[model samples]
Target chain A: MLILHCPYCGVYAEETELHAGGEAHLKRATIGDSDEAFEEYLFMRENKKGVHLERWRHANGCGKWFLCARDTATLEVYGTYPAQTTEPPADIVAAITAKHPGWSWKEKA
Target chain B: MSNAVSALNGQEAKGDVTVRELGLTGMITLRGDFEDENFGAALSQITGAGVPDVRHFVQAGDFTVLWMSPDELLVILPYEKAAETVAAFDAALKGTHFLAVNVSDARALISISGDFANEVLAKLSPVDMSADRFTAGMVRRTRLAQVAAAFWMLPDGSYNLMCFRSVADYAFGLLSTSAKAGKVGAI
Candidate 1:
């Protein structure tokens, strides 16, 4: 079972106390956008095997939603940050880069 | 006006630990900027207790202030004083961006006391309920069995648990069952 730290309440909650909210930092397509763009926005996902960013809610704890950066294969948590942030914080990016080396969110490592 | 009643009607059970419903506790959900001087001052004045730190609670006189989140607090006091206290909060924080709502009737309070109180709670919650880890003054808002609940240890080593009123009977049943299941002998 995964153990995650909730940034809002500062509690190290286990997987049972949290709910996975899929991918993070998704960009919504505007009304004028093409059908292809809307389809990509709605259905496409990275589903990367390595470091990934996801949203999680402290469902049984503080009831606040937050973002988590972790390795999908190793289950190593890079860091956790508040949900209000549009992208991963500099520190989280730095941590991920240090271990994975030249890794970026959308680009191949 | 109609008469007010507690969810469990003050039911209790005795086993390795004692589980009892603490009827009609006054609770106020306060949300705002904790750093604002006016907010702190008004809360202290109304609840007679200062703001609690992260995952902690503080008691003064008849009130206890629990740190619920980054910008939220749960103030517990005598049931009869809930409305007047909300009014007082409104009066004291006239110009501040804050929310103080009476949640006394919307929730249920239960007490578990005995030498094995920690074990009883440890069965239901995912928290570290050892005496050294979950000592007095700390408050934890987590799941109790399948429901959301918050609990804090009193100075007397007893535990006070709070959950939504609708689930009071379920919470009571879980507590009593846990109490009767025998101690874990670890905590």
Candidate 2:
């Protein structure tokens, strides 16, 4: 039973109450950008076993979209934030760093 | 919406629970900024109750305005007044980014009373159904029996559960089966 905390509804919803949306916070590459950039935007998505960020929707609950930081292999959820945020909140990143040391994500030192 | 008998219309299968399909009750889905100066007052005018905050409801007579989300609410009114309520809201807020839709015909409401109503709902949903966690006037938008539904708990301990009209049969079946199963150990 995978449980996710929906920031909007303020409820820890089970997987049945949620729909998993794949990657989060990807910059769109449109016309005038190089083919490589467009391909990277459309085709290249992360399938990480360590720390990762993804989109999720509380479809059966409040029907709001949110973001989740989790470890894919261990299924240990670090935290969840609203989807409108352009980046993961600081505390979430810090929690992921403290648990899984030497993790690599975008723009994280 | 439809006054047709629900799938579980007359079936009372050995339990203290009394499940009845409520007649066509009016419903509207209203979306607006509660922070807007004219929003709450206009909603109160239509529903005859003070505007409720998110995850709660304000009761007025038999009508209740339930807060569905930060910017959305469900207005429960008389069946004949569903369209009238939406029209009134549209006329009231003529220049706001709001959506007032009449959903009376698109949803189904059923009531389950007696001692087992709480337990039956708890079995089907992830919400905390205890009296302390879900008190009166608290409206929760949660899943009921594998379908999306909203629960409005009244002060008398009865519950009015609403779901999409298309899933009325499924909702009724799940509720009846769960109600009966709670009565005895066997199916």
Candidate 3:
């Protein structure tokens, strides 16, 4: 029973009240993109066991989609942010870096 | 007009608590920038209640303003006044980026009252129904069993709940069943 905070509604919603949207910050492959690129965009995902970023919808509460960063093994939530943001906020990134040094998403240090 | 009917036609059930269907209540869905001066003034002028803070509601005379989300509000009033209220919004907020529509017929209202009203609701919702955590003036939008619903505590310790009209019978049944299951004795 994972409890996550909804950044939009400011409510700590249980997993039952939310819908998981898998990976976060996905860049869709356009029409002219290569088949491999399109396949990577559609199917490939990071199977990180430590820090992970994911999308979640507060389906039963505010009905807003948001992003979450958490540890897959320890279930320690890094933070939650609005979906409109392109990347995790500086404070959230700093928090993640503090706990897991040299950690980066998509090779962006 | 006269032919309009409520979802359950004013049905009610009795148990440890009373679950009564409040027939034909008026509701309006309003979405806009809460920070806009015109938005706040127009809402206060029409509803006679200030814009409520997050997760809260304010009542004045026959009107209640509920904060549904960051940019949405639910205005509850007498059923007969819905159309006029919507027109009033158009008149007051002519150039503002706002939306106010009559939703009176699309939803159903229910009231659960008695000593164990909170206990009855606690069985279905994931919200903290404890008196200290959820008190008067606060509104919570949550799932009631399998359906989406919103509820708030009244001044007299009762709760007024609302859900889509299509599930009125189901909501009534759920409420009554929870009321009959007896109290949990733990807050």
Error of 3 at B108 (Å): 0.6
Docking class of 1: medium
Candidate 2 Cα errors over 4 Å, as ranges: A102-104, A107-109, B1-14, B183-187
Worst 10 residues of 3 chain A by lDDT: A100-109
Per-residue lDDT over B18-56 for candidate 3, one digit per residue giving the tens place of the 0 to 100 score: 999999899999999999999999999999999998889
User: Stretches of candidate 3 above 4 Å error?
Assistant: A28-40
From the highest TM-score down, the ranking of the candidates is: 1, 3, 2
Q: How would you encode candidate 1's per-residue C-alpha lDDT over A1-62 as one tens digit per residue?
A: 89999998888999989999999998899999999889878999888888999999999888
What does DockQ give for each predicted structure? 0.78, 0.66, 0.73
TM-score of 2: 0.91
lDDT of 1 by residue, B68-160 (tens): 988899999999999999999999999889999999999999999998999999999999998888999899999998999999999999999
Model 3 is docked with a DockQ of: 0.73
- After the best TM-score superposition of candidate 2, give how far the Cα of residue B12 lies from its true spot, in angstroms: 7.2
- Candidates in order, interface RMSD in Å: 0.9, 1.2, 0.9
Question: Could you give the interface RMSD of candidate 3 in angstroms?
Answer: 0.9
